[model samples]
Target: MPEVVQNVSKEGVKYIILGCGRTGYNVAEELAKETEDLIIVDKDEKRVEDLRDQKYNALVRDFSNPGFMDGLPVPEVAFILANDREANLAALKTIKSRYPATYVIARAIDAVSVDLLQQEGADVVLYPQEVVARTAIYHIRKLHSSRLALRLYDLLASWEGTLCIVTHLNPDPDSISSAMALSLIARHASHNKLNCRIVYEGDIGHQENRAFINLLDIKMERLTPQMLEECGYIALVDSSGPGVNNNLPKSTRVNIIIDHHKNNTQPPSAVADFIDIRPGVGATASIMTQYLMELDIPVSKTVATALLYGIRADTRDFKRNVTPQDLNYAAFLLPLTDADLLDKITSPSVSLETIEIIGNAIRNRKINSGYLFSNVGYIRNRDALPQAADMLIHLEGVNTALVYGITDQNIIISARNKDIRLHLGNVMAEAFGSIGEAGGHATMAAAMIPLSYFSMAKDKEGLLTLIIDPILKRFSEIVGLDGEGEE
Candidate 1:
């Protein structure tokens, strides 16, 4: 064993690099800027000499040999960077046996070696190939996003009039934030040449959703036919097409569609010039964040917070239908988001009507097999249906929950499902598509039937009572339930 040549004092040595390979040398160079209490050792005499020439404390030693580090001071950290798997594992076991307290970071040639290295007491295992592949993938995604951003900019710049960015009716955090992001993108892409307005058709009925908009001060207007007519171009956010979840007329022409919903009815390309619908993504806001990053646009604190909340809400805090892309976008926005504002947005005061609706849903609940159904009577707050359904799904023995309420113009429905065999979106569409609009994701879904469909009834309560049984029966049948349990 060759002794470590002391270029700098080895007193209070805290770090050691066991190889002078490419990764080890690069790490040593970086750590050199932070501390001089580090040494680099390699079996190759020429590599050691080269490191010493650069003023690094270099030594020629066989790290895989037992007792190689016996005379050296116990380092707080040791990096074993040999490419040979057997040598690296041997080095790792030897170091951990002597200095059990030392944090050993070992390099592995592959995943199998990684596990072996860790079992031998490597505190961390670095697979350089995996690291490089991940870095490359991240950059490639950014490059692709930049190309898409440029294409979107070119499309926006091609048109010269006002751009109406539409969100789905009763816009939640995801749709609202997505629309806001698209508006920002439109402003940047057109260089302020396009007048952009965030437009929607339904009320921001959820209390938390209201707080999100009020806290962020997001500007959105109710969509009117005149606004659509005035705009030279139109874009849909969190909505795939006209007359789908939105109140847009079927004849309306859309220029751009950005959504994360899985829609088989109308491909966005058929309805829009620029379409970015990725059903695999948890939120449309994630797609918007990608655009912001690739375009190098400055994200405001408000926008950052909204986009973060949007991702959380759509993904249910990364628990539902989440993908790697959503997480990546969220990580990018986390540092820029305002933590206090997010807390306030997510913890808004609950409304009395919402509580009452939830109470009604619980009181009127009916169970058949594992399916739970509830009618919340008549509701002025349409957003409460989903909240009620979300709560009902948690009941014991229930894998699916459906809540419906009668509004003045529509019979609103909201559903939540955890049964792996069930597809709630398709079930809702099949159950209600003939009389109304309905669709959503697998774990969640919704429907809306015009009250006019049941106008034959004399009164609201009578109408609700008469139609509830049939609707529940139809839904139960669609889900393939065998028997109707006594309620």
Candidate 2:
């Protein structure tokens, strides 16, 4: 790569760009799939101002003054792409000192700083000479790939083509939106590319979720034992692995995987040529949003609204697990989301069933070990469990809220917390250790218990007792309770 270096080492001025500034339009395009929190910082005020004008968050102050960024979200991941080796190291050091956990990937001008930057905790050191030369080569290869696709289309006698089976780990607004968006991209970009049918596992159990599918009318093929047999290719979103119920047929290979969750111990990855997993990102919709923008694709009002809802719900409206990509993509999608329609999606009315569930929770709620437990009986809508858990966390005595409800198919449990008492995913996973699948974000989690299975326990009382015991014990552990109640 060093021998192929042609362009001067230019780094860190632009981050999370799908393409270079017109050089090839997609410099290191694969990086965009992996990149989550991308920030471009420069000592030049004009450059920062220019970026700010373009809706990029830019701090004009010099790097020497830490106070300059008191309010701004300091970048945890730093890319030292500057040609000057000295300044590059300074930027890397500054980022490291500020964000200890940040992965600093620096561009070494020569061999001198490569090893030194590696020792200095730079996760990746890119040689400028090599990357610049490959940029042109990358563009030509992309052009050829597209040309080949077009050429192949003319040869296909049948209009009907294969389907890209798109689904996610746990179906949510972001995951579904991305699956739809990606399929749309793949269909439009390739002249004679295969048709795609979006599919997913898990219930679309959120208000925004209902709005996305209903308003957008994005057709998602329902996956069943029979459907999996015919599907030849799979595209996974939100999550990755076999532990998830969305597992494709063993013969059906995965073609692409776009996810935002951190990697975990899951089954062998599906066969995918393009795999983009941004762990630091809050939403995969953000990534797709950028692709549409760059490709000059016109997003419909409903699609925009869905994208906005997807980003907002996934990030909790930029409260947690947010990154520059999320913010930038959100800024781009804001105007596209109808102002009047947003009100409808944002504060959709709750069902009477949900309201009754809340009232029942208030009446039968128990506060013990600084935890709130509302084992609401049978729930018509499983979505109510998450809303119940989220509401219970606001109660004064509650640091953790576990809301469990039995639906016809599964016993759904939702957990919400403020402190690091217990990782909700692990808690729910252990609770359903050998029963059913359960995993999610650190602060929020969802578990499914097959009623047919749970109800078949030795006795009715025993089944209920066994299911609720884990919640009680975990809460007691967090609050230092000695297995006894507050009394």
Candidate 3:
């Protein structure tokens, strides 16, 4: 168990458990150690007696009955663990409808029920069989000698054709490094049976990103529709769901997906045969690092440096949304990584256009209740918008920053937030998702709205108003502001 999980405290919280089956009993027993205010209810007299004998608060009543719940106190947490699907559903509905504020967790018997329970207002739905299978896999991998990696290798070894590893468009350090690490894994796993190729779409225009790719010698091909059709197996790294940010078509059959984004709107199992999406993990490189460690694969200095940089970039040098796994992997990769090469990658020469973009952002910035917005007119290097947004958020009075500019056929928007209460990705999605594809992490997000969405204006100033006005209007609606005019 991780130290973080073990150290979680449930002090002063009340728990109400419905059903006294093996699952419920076990949960109540464990939770009893955390808090004293626990109530266990069961329809069976024998099960109720069992809890009573153990000196636990027990009630003999139908958990699905609204009368039974009406007499009880509104608990902070409620658990429905009935074996019958209908009974569990009834209990879940009752708890949610009666105690709307309570956090309810219900047991699910099958994969189909998981979705149903969630739709019915269960805050969390537990599937024991799936949990057990996952736990078994975890233990089997740990106890056996490179069993998980070997199993993955065996699967790749069976393939007699090409394997394509795809990364998100405008590949970041995490996406690029993760693809390289997966390619390395495939090389070690199947020798030469699987011809693995790394591919991506969009420009690597960021100075640091280009330097990282060049210094590490990470080779990636530009993905095309024809190339995708020729591959036997497709693996997505640091990206989940097709047709989102990746170049892969929605109908493309994927064999594997490894990503750290928790808010993947697509059902992972539907798109890939082998899915490993760990939202708790800060970076996909950390996940790949664990696999390398488990397989005992030799980590070359170049690979180490890339993986370390991936983790650092994703976590913002461990200053933003970080997890224990990221810290552990960073520690593991630190010694093997080339420090001098890392410094070189980090200190790339900035372009004059990027400097001018930042200057324009500063001069044209507008602030509304701690939220700063900037329009850096026509920018060739679209990547500089994000760099400027990140810099603008560091201003003393700013809690959030949005920077946008016109480039080619798209109006690119990059957003950053220092406020923990705001999810910038969701904000971006709400503001411009209908016009374009927009989504990202909590602190950092980006949106690309096509130029066709705006009415073409003849002059520069008219075009600026035509392009930026709608974006500001939508954003202002979301943040509850009455339109802060341009500075």
> Candidate 3's residue-wise lDDT over 438-464, tens digit each?
888788998888877453544544576
Q: Which candidate gets the maximum TM-score versus the true structure? A: 1
| All candidates in order of lDDT, best leading | 1, 3, 2
CA lDDT of each prediction against the hidden true structure: 0.86, 0.64, 0.83
Best by lDDT: 1
Q: Which 10-residue span in candidate 3 carries the lowest summed lDDT?
A: 1-10
Model 2 segments more than 4 A misplaced: 1-160, 229-232, 242-251, 420-436, 450-452, 455-467, 474-479, 483-487
Better of 1 and 3 by lDDT: 1
Q: Kindly provide the TM-score of model 3 when superposed on the true structure, using C-alpha atoms.
A: 0.67
Candidate 2 lDDT (Cα, 0 to 1): 0.64
Off by over 4 Å in 1: 1-15, 32-39, 44-59, 72-78, 82-141, 419-423, 439-442, 456-458, 478-487
Candidate 3's C-alpha runs over 4 A off are 1-147, 453-462, 484-487
Alpha carbon lDDT at 220, candidate 2: 75
